[model samples]
Target: MSSHSHHTIRQAILDRIQTGEWALGELIPGEAMLADEYGCARTTINRALQGLANDGVVIRKRKGGTRVCDMPVRQAKFNIPVVREQVEALGSVYRHQVTRRVEKAPPTAVQKRLGLAPGTKSLQLDTVHLADDRPFAFETRWVNTRAVPAILDAPLDEISANEWLVQTVPFSSGDVVFCAVNAGKDVAEALGAREGAAVFVIDRTTSLAGEFITTMQLYYREGYQLHSQL
Candidate 1:
């Protein structure tokens, strides 16, 4: 039999999750079992399951086994004001507009996030988050070119920089921070708010073995809320 790519395996796993075949809190079949069902090697199944766990879509543990989490971490963001859910919750159309995507030496902010010097090149993606044709947020993301060189050919607007990079590049560790801030002119304009307006700010930095992967800043309009319940 031909070897199956990890992407194929991942799609099959995602299908099972979406179809309710793998109910929340249910343990996934063992690697050997999955391999037999899919006619693939255990390695292929491992790659797919590992990726799902990294994306917070499922829970995987050595002894606990892989299981559908009753309250999946991915869904936790929905209770929060995720850009996608924020727009959808308002009963308006959600849209993403890429402002710019460029490769250049790291900016000051990038350096701060990655602990890089002045000469390191990184891919920068700037975008506006929209709802019903109105600007709602501004997203600025920087990816370490050394970590994910294929980012050069990736399309903007087709997918979020954060989502695409996360799937394409595997990072060992990362951190997300949320805060409240007063928006400046650029942020206010992009988010359609008055200058110095109150807004929610989210900053994320991801790395692998001390090597930087990406840093993202999300600025949301005032009144935005991020909630999570255990």
Candidate 2:
């Protein structure tokens, strides 16, 4: 079989789980059985099941076999496209500016959200994304220096923190939240909009193997829409 066969097996298994064909807490067919069904090696089935286990979609035990999780911690698979790609996809020029970068104690709310210790120092970045010379989105991010020390030397002025992090850091799990908020003074000024204008916000926190990587909040100008597919 091709090296990529495991991905196909993974998707097939995920579809079965998601569609309820494999009920929660139900033991799936053994790896050997699945291999025979899929006409692939048992190792391919093992790899697929292991990936599902890592994503919290399945539980695997040496003697208990593999089963659908009773309460699956389903992770939303959102592909965070780079802001530059988003702008360029809209047939506009993409530009980004790093307005601020500092190392300081994060706010109490930020600390609580990220489960950080009090007085913990983090690298904070404020950036504005533009499309066709107009404000597209404003971003504020806090990065755990201990988790990603390379950011300390990376040039933020020439490259946006979002793009840089996407390229440099690898994450295994994350949480995403969406909301609507009124633009405050800082966000309003950065987006060239009046105060209290409605804006769409996307907040994301990412972790690498259970260690915090970064938390970012992206505030898009009015009329922005987020799209995703199952």
Candidate 3:
């Protein structure tokens, strides 16, 4: 397609790979050539190719160029879910409130994970997501204001940061971690569960290009199951 966006170009490349036009482990076209063919900027082609590389679809070398993966890896894909939609999808009314919002120095672990200098102030938000007037999840997050300065002007009191970030940021790649944890006091209080109760936790970090954006820990109400397709 002419003048196609990066996402469209990404899909087109995938289609070619699916139909065996691009053989496994074979080199693909360079960014300049793809840009000329698609009538889009070279940066668009680069972004599309970066997405494929993130998904393990292709390998790219700064000097050697790009190639289709000989053996594609199978991984479960999970898009960041909007909490309001998630609640409504479950046939429950969704309501949320920000319990805390402050700009403060994050923990050493958080700083290291984000590759930030020590004592960097990040926008920290603590919130409770409700379903049908009951607690659903508790979220603690750190926003990298350097990457997302708009978050400072966002009305956190009126909208959940979870929803706000999804609407405001365009992240290129992310990592998700799921685990089971015994609830601590703050999390138990937020979720209205007994202390020490088992809860599902999701830790997610997202970035655009090379800059880290945010990292968050979500503690779901006891017995919550994540249903996803592989």
Candidate 4:
């Protein structure tokens, strides 16, 4: 219990629910209580609960606390969000700048993630999306040119790569991860957040016919809230 990680705690919680230790629609232990039982910090417990809620396994209310969803959604889908569209929907002027773009060898991690051979070239881009001229999100992307060479011809400065890709490129499969990260200097500057401020990050990769298209990470500005329907 002393060295338990949040992922371990998450599985433990799920196991309990599956075993009927907590009945469906039952209120689960509060964070503080779970923290004590797991010999971990409350924040660790919090992360576990947050993951559960996002997966529709639980419901969280400001005053009612947390309870298991009576009928959990076993499967959920998240479409790629277009930055420009998101801003426009908020009734703000949408704009973006291609801060950096290069076609070079990707980092080893990105290379492996995209299953590229060593020294394979990738189109890397750093972009800052704006809402009414205020920074909204920072996008960092690595594209495998072999999968989608047309990206090289797109004018990213005029229209964000996100908008371009979503409109043109179609994907048959993809994966995504959502996490919170403390802003580093580059991300902080792009998003107008203080260094070390908590930022919401989305990491995604798409593939068409087993050929990976791209791997990208989007870091949103402070106070960005993601809404989803389950």
Candidate 5:
């Protein structure tokens, strides 16, 4: 099949869903059946289904197959930019440093966010990203070892965790929240800003299937703003 066939199939399936031919909570045909109907390979149908699943239009299960979501949560799709890319896009030298790496029981807040058991252990990383030899952002992240064990052996000192995870991991669903907060002592020191100064905060959580992957909070120094176009 041609490369554009998947896009055609994706649009066809989306039209079916939007037109109510595939009603909510209805189990659609499996990939093999769809491929037979469309005269394409099963892999192509799987790709289309995956795209729908990623956009929250459908839900997929290993044994239960794919189904229309009862309440489809439309996702605002955007590329998760790597820290190095964000810095270099502004014509600045990008640098990364790993300040701390440890395996320990996560704090109550993180545990609650990841839906971990009481005694779950996670890999915590503290990193500072630099642009042109100046502090850019301070990052505190927790990786669910059970979901992504390969992260334990990664060389984070050479690559920021944000950059590495974006390149290596395949997350099915995630959410990001942005806010403004007053920098505390540690954050202030890391970003070379005065304590209590206003800082931009980005909190993100990623998951694959039903398993948690990582949760991170990034603190950007004063005057930082995130710009994007739809």
Candidate 6:
């Protein structure tokens, strides 16, 4: 409102979101309404709101409008996507490598998260997300065969489920959590880091059309950081 300060607008929007004054999935007021409330011009409100959406603090749709999220986890707020686009943002080449793939029974922990009964069939995919051939993330993903049964027979070495999902699937809801974990032998090898090193782990569960789709764990090297403005 006062010369379009990022700090001012971000705090105001965040206060509303945290206070539950704006519930998740509820459309935000239009720019005109916000301008009236904030005592600012429509341009200022537009700039403020646009910055919030870009920072993953809000979801903006052309006709659907902006809405608050159900699970407002800050780490889960942004979609990091593949490292290729990230590195390319700084003018670097993106690279990828598939380490392994196996169709096997889902682990007990994975089964519980997917709400699957014990001994459900699943496919495990291990991959290294790289930037300019340097390890960026160690990703171990489990695809629920019941959700996408054909994954069992597909050549996972050629394409990642993350890539495929962007094209074919639409998620209804998601559960995401982030934590710090020690890089064990498997994780070290995948991320090209030393064993026992500290890494950031992001676990994501995606649902499509109200049904469980897949659950994935993404591990990033120590230096990796999630950044945002507003």
Best by TM-score: 5
* Candidate 5 Cα errors over 4 Å, as ranges: 1-76
TM-scores, all models, native as reference:
0.63, 0.67, 0.68, 0.67, 0.69, 0.62
> Candidate 1 on 12-52: residue-level lDDT in tens?
77656544566666788988898898898889889988877
Residue 129 in model 3: shift from native, Å? 0.3
Task: Pick out the ten consecutive residues of candidate 6 with the lowest summed lDDT.
Answer: 69-78
User: In the order shown, what is each candidate's alpha-carbon RMSD?
Assistant: 7.7, 11.2, 9.9, 16.1, 10.8, 13.2
What would the per-residue lDDT of candidate 3 be over residues 1-230, giving only the tens digit for each residue? Answer: 36678999887776665445676678999999989988889999999999988866678998999987654122215667778888899999999989889999999999977779999999999999999999999999999987777789888878889887765455556789999999999999999999999999999997654668899999999878887665
Give a tens-digit lDDT track for model 2, residues 150-189. 7888888878999877655555578889999999999999
lDDT of candidate 2 at residue 4, scale 0 to 100: 47
User: What RMSD value applies to candidate 4?
Assistant: 16.1
Clashes of 1: 1
lDDT of each: 0.73, 0.83, 0.82, 0.83, 0.81, 0.70
Sort the candidates on TM-score, descending order. Answer: 5, 3, 2, 4, 1, 6
What local lDDT does model 6 show for residue 230?
A: 62
Q: Please give the distance, in angstroms, between residue 80's alpha carbon in candidate 4 and its true position after superposition.
A: 0.6
List the lowest-lDDT window of 10 residues for candidate 1. 72-81
- Of models 4 and 5, which has the larger TM-score? 5
Q: For residues 150-174, write the lDDT of model 6, one tens digit per residue.
A: 5665555566666655433434468
In the predicted model 4, the residue pairs found to clash are none
Candidate 2 regions off by >4 Å? Answer: 1-76
Better of 4 and 6 by TM-score: 4
Error of 1 at 187 (Å): 0.4
The sequence of per-residue lDDT tens digits that candidate 4 reaches over residues 1-230 is: 48888889987886665445675567988999999998999999999988877656678898888987654122225668899988998999999999999999998999998999999999999999999999999999999887667778888888899887765554546799999999999999999999999999999987643567799999999899998765
Error of 6 at 120 (Å): 1.6
